[model samples]
Target chain A: MSKTVIKVENLFKEYHLGNIGYGTLREDLSTWWAKVRGKEDPNSLIGHTKTITNKILESHFLALNDVSFEIKEGEAVGIVGKNGAGKSTLLKLLSRITYPTSGSIKVRGRISSLLEVGTGFHPELTGRENIYLNGAILGMKKYEIDKKIDEIIDFSGIEKFIDTPVKRYSSGMYVRLAFAVAAHLESDILILDEVLAVGDAEFQKKCLGKMDDVTRNQGRTILFVSHNMSAVQNLCSKGILLEKGAIQTQGSIDEIFETYNLNTHHQQCIKLDERIDRTGNGQLKFTNIQLINANNQIINSVLPNEKITIRVHFRINKVININNVKINICIDNFYGARIAVISTDNDVNFTTNFNNDFISRGYIDFTFPKINIIPGNYTIVLYSTVNNELSDWIKNDALTFSINEFDYYESGKTSANGHGYIFLDYKIK
Target chain B: MDNDEKWDLIIKPAGSLNFNLKELLHYKFLMYLFVKRDFVTYYKQTILGPLWYIIQPLLTTLVFTVIFGNIAKIPTDGIPTTVFYLIGITFWGLFSESMSSTSNIFVTNAQIFGKVYFPRLTVPIARITSNYIKFFIQLVLFFGFYFYFLFFTQYMKPNLYLLFVPLICIQFSIIAFGIGIIISSLTTKYRDLQFVVTFGVQLWMYATPVIYPLSNIPSKWLWVFIINPIAYPMELLKYAFTGQGIVNFTYLGISFGTSILLLIVGLFNFNKVEKDFMDRV
Candidate 1:
């Protein structure tokens, strides 16, 4: 049976906020007393997100809080989080690059972390020299390196310039050498911090192949932290979701992703741009478009091909040719992946309703009537066009959005692969 | 212990002072490689190359003789002024140079430290070893000048007590290393220490017997000089080479004891600072 290679317990890390915590002696003493008594931290609850951010005056913040998890031998764990979610901090702590404010990490074997690419390599030194230096840094003796030098060079595939100084090498070459050394380090545990982001697609594929081999052949435990969700889902068997220095969930890949899918909350950010703003010098500028269902409440979720009302209210700022006024609408997923686009250019006829009061400031409405896409979290981006050409673009984060699985197929069945992706089907003879 | 425990001993944080001897022994190959890099790279692209080693002390000795021997008309304890100043500068050079370079270990190698982890002390150990190569060259020149004076002039007397000079050199190195690592930790925060060290090390030579004889210091100043500790080992080193030292067992004992104390303090501070310096530095 596989033994536990790593065990972490109640690991807590705190940071000093300096004078920004806004407390005099009495308040500070009380806070300190509360901290000692393990009460709710007074400052921890006050970090509410706000609009009109005034120059980001944060003195200190907890990069990582009490994070605790364990991995058995040869287990590959993927740490996934948005920006500022403390994924890198967890990796740094595991790598021993920095000490925790309060925590202990116990591991049964040696750990080698590839936190960044081209780390510990001197530009003035040759690839050969860097390999030896990196080997020593990774706790390998010269004889050990002597045996593996060729293998590392072969893996890195920069042999033409192996004797050349590293400064001359491209960033890709640098990461290749660095990753080669790190992968060959032979530690029982390998910690990676999105190091694959530095390499090209082919090299990333090679590295993934190498990582797969490491886990399968050597039975090494691997911990990976990455922002790429697709890559994480593909590479890791287990997934850990972090949200603002705390773990939201950890479980099997599909289960955690599903929970992540269910739990991510949306505090909608509404913005008025030229595409959706009524202040422009045109016939009509879309200022606001709120999605409504049978219930007038904010449509928090929806299914694909559902009959949803997209109420786009706009007003004219000035009178003009009213020539070719177009509203371009694009629906995008969380990773900025555009799912679909709807535009007035596809309309058969252009309608012009002109009024002097409406020319100065009046409202026009556009109803999508129906949305045909798979179930997903999405935002609508709007752009304004005049004379069949774009005059301005407006970005609405969540305009008439929140899609669900109501997009119908001819067969009336979801694709075997999935329903949420690009679908192209034709009957064969 | 079995293989599982042996792997843990090295990969784990060190718990006691006994050291992971087997791991260090395994890493000896790295140590040797580092030392070779240091020794070879010094003269790699220089004009005079290794000749600069011998040329450095010879010219300094000549310049000092002109300043203190002829101009200042200072006494050299009845020894030749050339030999007197040469020995003083030699000992002072080794001790002070080692101190100055070792002091900036972390500051000079901050890039390397931020990037990866190895035995951080390995750099200093390599640096001290590199300085010895230069020291050996200077030793030969000192001997060359001594023999020349022995054959050509009337000032000639050898001392067998010089056999113990290597031990004194080793002691001076350890003391320098201890002090160096300590200053290295501080320089990580106060980078001004790096700038201060060059001038500080140069000024330190004046307090020791670099330009003057040990006898020139008044007996009343003995207690103050004894407390410094570097003064005695350096002065003893000069005496070992030139046979003109005021060799006292009490002074030697005090300096040796002080060196041991400094070494302990240095290692303790160095270990304490390694964890968080990547943030501050």
Candidate 2:
């Protein structure tokens, strides 16, 4: 059994919403007076719960609230969470980039974080110079960089442009060089945050291999944070699931993934209008989205070739005159790669209904008599545009549903095996 | 595990002012690399390259000579106007540039500082060290002019006080760095201080007698000039080169004491802010 290398206890971090300094001298004086009187800070709302309403009630944001965990030596722990789940804050605290508002962390050895690769790379500096600069920034000594410069160059595969300024290097080469330096850093504990999300598939595979070697062969403790479930399952032996500034569960990788999937897929209908994480002109908004079977019963698990209808209820806040208004819905697999796009542009009645003035609230029904897809969880991205130009609203991950494995071709075979993301109908001749 | 066993590192919200001297000493090579990066990248894309280092103070000296020497008729204590103002501007350039850049260390490098962990003091130290290269180049230019004036005219004079040049340089660096880090700590939350720093350093130059000799000030007002910490270093530089200007031991003592005080305050504040600056910055 390995000894514990990192121990974090009761960590909490709070952040002010706006300027750290009070906006006015009067506000500052008032706060100072409150402090002198031993009263609660006039500007702080530390214990208040945050609501998803339009009113911005609280000024203090709790980024991490009483989070605690321990990592043993040589344990590869994957931190998984949705956006705004405090994953980055936990990593930041561990790396000592920021301190917790309270609590403590004890470490037994040197730890380096590749929160972002090539963080301090100066664009004007040559690739070779940036290598030294980045290496030093990551706490590598001068002689260590000099000894490993050749290996870094060879691994990055940019020897021809080593002397060239990094500003001129293509973005692919840039990430390659940056990841190379970070991968070569010799430290007892390594922290990585979504670093493999960049580069092509082959490069990502190479990085995964390198990460595996670093943990399994070198016996280095690794803390990895990513939304890529498959990659996390491959590289991490343990897992931590963070939800809303708190750790929801911690266990083996499989157990954590199972808990995560169950928690995220519990909600069958998504109240899109209540979601705060969206971007658009705000003229139109998705009110609710639900997946229903042919019997009009709400469902979250559907088999391939089953008749399903996606009902997207929307509200037009303001009446606008537009000729070509269309809704685009894209289906993305669990890895966040788009599988297919279903748009209303091909429907002849889409433009006719939007031209009327009284159409403020309506539902757009997409009936897929025979859904074609593999067995996996999927998300939908819904967007509406006017005149094929300006986007009125766009909501990502508006709805999520899982596809149950089924033999659609009646051959007792499903695409859940070694096949790809889509199922094709076939016959043995 | 033994109860007395010590972990390699323990992180907390705040720490005492041991200054982490051992950690800093261990990462000395990183400091050197930061200094080298600053030097190399400062002139990376410029066409004139290192010539800009010479050109900056040279041009400033020329402009000051015409404005203060000829137009304003400022006295230089009988030394040639060119060499006197050159020495003043060169020394002052080292102090002021280091001070201003060091004061903005946290703001300018917030991106890198937020992403990685290192001794934050290394950045300010590296800046002061790298700037010495520019100061050295300008020093060579000053000496070239000094030799010309010494060989060609009788107005030039040399004295044993010239040996104090190294001490004066170190004193100047300590004072500037001390003040710089303090302002940097405050500016992380109150960005208005950044603007105040720019205007204050400019006004501070006028108060330090960079353009005129110390002798030009009347005796009754001498106390006002002596209180400014930079005035001591400026007067020392002038006395070493031209063999003129006041070299009062009492004034130097006051300046040195104040610098030490400022350094303690600066380091305490820097250490305090380094823990949580990312929260605000």
Could you list the chain B TM-scores for each candidate?
Answer: 0.89, 0.96
**Could you give candidate 2's per-residue lDDT for residues B221-272 as a string of tens digits?**
8777777988977888788888888898889899889888888898898998
Q: Clash pairs of candidate 2?
A: none
TM-score of each: 0.72, 0.88
Clashes by residue pair, model 1 = A276-A286, A302-A404, A303-A404, A304-A404, A304-A405, A304-A406, A304-A407
Compute the lDDT of residue B275 as modeled in candidate 1: 65
Q: Compose the digit string of candidate 1's lDDT tens values, residues A260-331.
A: 555433323534533332222454566666776756554757655545666556655544554446766777
lDDT of 1 by residue, B6-120 (tens): 2242222222243335755666666766776676567765898889888888898899999889999988888888888888778777888789878988777777666555667
List per-prediction Cα lDDT, in the order shown.
0.71, 0.83
Per-candidate RMSD, Å? 10.3, 4.4
TM-score of chain B of 1: 0.89
**Model 2: per-residue Cα lDDT at residue A261:** 75
Give TM-scores of chain A for all candidates: 0.60, 0.80
